[model samples]
Target: MAASTCVRAGEISPGHDSFTGSPSTADRLTGSVAVDGQRRHGGSSRDVRRGRPTLVCPCLPVVDGLSSGRLDQDEGVSSFRKGDHGEPDSVRFEAAGLRWLGEAPGGVAVAEVLSEGPGWLETARVHPGGATAAAAEQLGRALARTHAAGAPHLGCPPAGWTGDGFMGRAQLPLRGTPGPDSWGEFYAADRVLPYLAGAVANGAIDTAGERTVRRCADRLATGELDAPQPRLVTRPAARLHGDLWSGNVLWGERDGIVAATLIDPAAHGGHAESDLAQLGVFGAPHLDRVVAAYDEISPLAPGWRERVGLHQLHMLIVHAALFGGSYGRQTVRTAARYA
Candidate 1:
């Protein structure tokens, strides 16, 4: 039995996804997450499907993978949840009065200390051992509520751009945007292109493959990609959990729960649907329920499913960067079939 660190600076570990030597994980961790305060494992996607783990920590929101942040160890109520496209960067430790400290010895620093309530984190729960259709509907409604939270005041820049995705700092330059004008531009620049460079640098992809990414990025940039105008948000950019997948959705029937804040986010602003589509891609529990829920709060832009292949390619490329070529190949296949 081994344990893994996760979804954020390694705090939200999966049951068996990451193993560090022996069957046990060291309790001590660096930077944030208030080391040892609480170890919350939101179970795996399968667990959620069965309707187990119905009880969710109101303070913790479910999320996709992990990441590292950029701040040195300090203390405050992280305005955002530390994360990236894959996993969390830094673990955050917050003291009273909004003081925050962080540690991401594993990677970069991910901390946006803030003390306010997390309305966007949204609801997350796992169905430890049950399967109820109503639970699915409940989850659906909850997600809709999260999307309806409206744009909040911004603090840090909305970003998922990482130099790590590049070959030894051979970063792909994205046009400077204090923030993006639309979700399409933001996703194209940050998620799609940068990860392709990282995959090339990591040897998962060749220069030729990288060219495809450039082609894709260029298309979106020029509005030439054969696709509809993304339901991409323009004004306010809108806060989004940079990575959203099946594991991020927790299945539970929490009464009176309006929404669950997005925790462990590679937080930024772009198409909120990015999260929804991702959920569908990874087969998040009660996916139909979540979509139904989202629709109630605010309807989805049409033809969202068809774009899954397009959005999922970004995630696969990211995997290639962090792991290896298979993900790259998978990405290429998807691109050939879709956008």
Candidate 2:
């Protein structure tokens, strides 16, 4: 029963300046946790790779096994450990999402993934620092490139990803329906309404709030929110981080300045605006700079600003489903704007 050290050298700090972006928050909203312990042993790199699980409990024997010393030397070992209820396949889905999006042409920077199994995942640890305007701008351009990578269709999962996906702890279906023919329809059916229904079922939303959201859905169904395109969306479905809240953005210092590295992505294919709007969810630093830079490279549609709330509705309802508090009220208020 050795106490687990949640962080070690090269690990992201647990503070406002770290991954969560909230200086006062504790657990990561992104649902990632790291485990390590203090112990030393002599083993080859392969031995360390095979011995990572033992590191989760420092009390384990070191006589013939792995150690952080060996792992650190590898320079590619993930700096954290996590386990779920014996269903490790979810971690594989997440790992695949990271690789598929990270390797896309001109993709945004992402945390390096070391390994993944049925119920565990390891990723290269990142040490975070303060945000910089330059870093925000760079992130914007990088995000533009990522979104521009495009996808086979809206609601498509990352290449090689199997089964339904997730956003934070909530299930996210990646399978797209045929003949939707418009972004508004895809979003209303696949993103907005499903979470809205969950929120209602869970009593997170009141009758009045549900009515407001339904009105918004009706508008979406009629394609009232579709950009200037006819029969098709004006913008193609872009690769999305799926969840881009500020906490998931790890800011790191390099050469005495700040830059961002993404982690815990719920990556999928969706409207690029969905990603952009989510950045402002908990509020990322230098947000204006990020948006300006993004516009410079891949300008948003005319009236995108007016549509920000539309895109944000999905996450807001998700929060209501998972937390069931102020988020629910906010969902109604946001939907009212469109209603």
Candidate 3:
């Protein structure tokens, strides 16, 4: 999602007027327009014919494919995401994830993918709404259904995608083949250690911090932290929204009522508790309700609460690698108990 202040349904955010159009009045719009620093191709054919400006955001960074903007077309309002040349497959990866997650029988509502092309992808826009308790509960139930969709193995990527995916701006390791037999092993190798090494190389964490995190990683690799699989999960892996931070969950209007719409996934196959733990990482609204609702449906493994920090270590280390500061310190502190 874009870093813009939340606005009510049908209202536009300040300083983003260039991309605005009346959802009810706009005609079918099409054609590619350069984003970020790319050269403008005059304007979309619809823009030229209708005497409107080409849709573009000048404030976005060149490498930020996740930066989003609104597009009002004849069908309705949609969210347009530009692709990053630096991360060529990011757009396709996200598209694949959305489709895969959406296929779950009773899964969480995802933004509908309207169209996609080489350098851009568009999806039905979710209008911002309050995170009501009812919405939170629905999100919980839906998320459990999504996890129950299952994947082929612990480290498998989305069904059709074979390459590595992106977690925010960082590389998210993935495997198409059957991965390690245990979730602990896959989590250590694909999730924690890679980001830990990056954090150390970037000076985000000191030697002591490295040792502490490595100790936790060693325990994870050895399956010391592995827990019994949830009763509902019959497969070796549960589908996961690899990055389930608060920002990625949009509480918005859906079907005339407020509901959660998941976006910007680093989707993969892993332990289900990781997704539940991530909701608490940055303080999601009504998080307790969400977790309770989820537990009602799927019944998490015993002692799952005690393992929250264990799962959260992956996200913390990724943040440490990307933005060295308190995140590094936080990672080390979180790893100490498990170490």
Evaluated with TM-score, which candidate comes out highest? 3
Candidate 3 Cα outliers beyond 4 Å, as residue runs = 1-67
Candidate ranking under TM-score, highest first, comes to: 3, 2, 1
**TM-scores for candidates 1 onward, in order:** 0.54, 0.75, 0.81
lDDT of 2: 0.65
Ranking of predictions according to lDDT: 3, 2, 1
Residue ranges of candidate 2 with Cα displaced over 4 Å? 1-78, 176-179, 228-235, 254-257
C-alpha lDDT score of every prediction, in listed order: 0.40, 0.65, 0.70
Q: How far off is residue 29 in model 2, in Å?
A: 14
lDDT tens per residue, model 2, 123-219: 6655556678889899988888888777777888888886788775578877744437687888888888888877887787999999999999888
Residue 338, candidate 2: C-alpha displacement in angstroms: 0.9
Could you give me the TM-score of model 1 versus the true structure?
Answer: 0.54
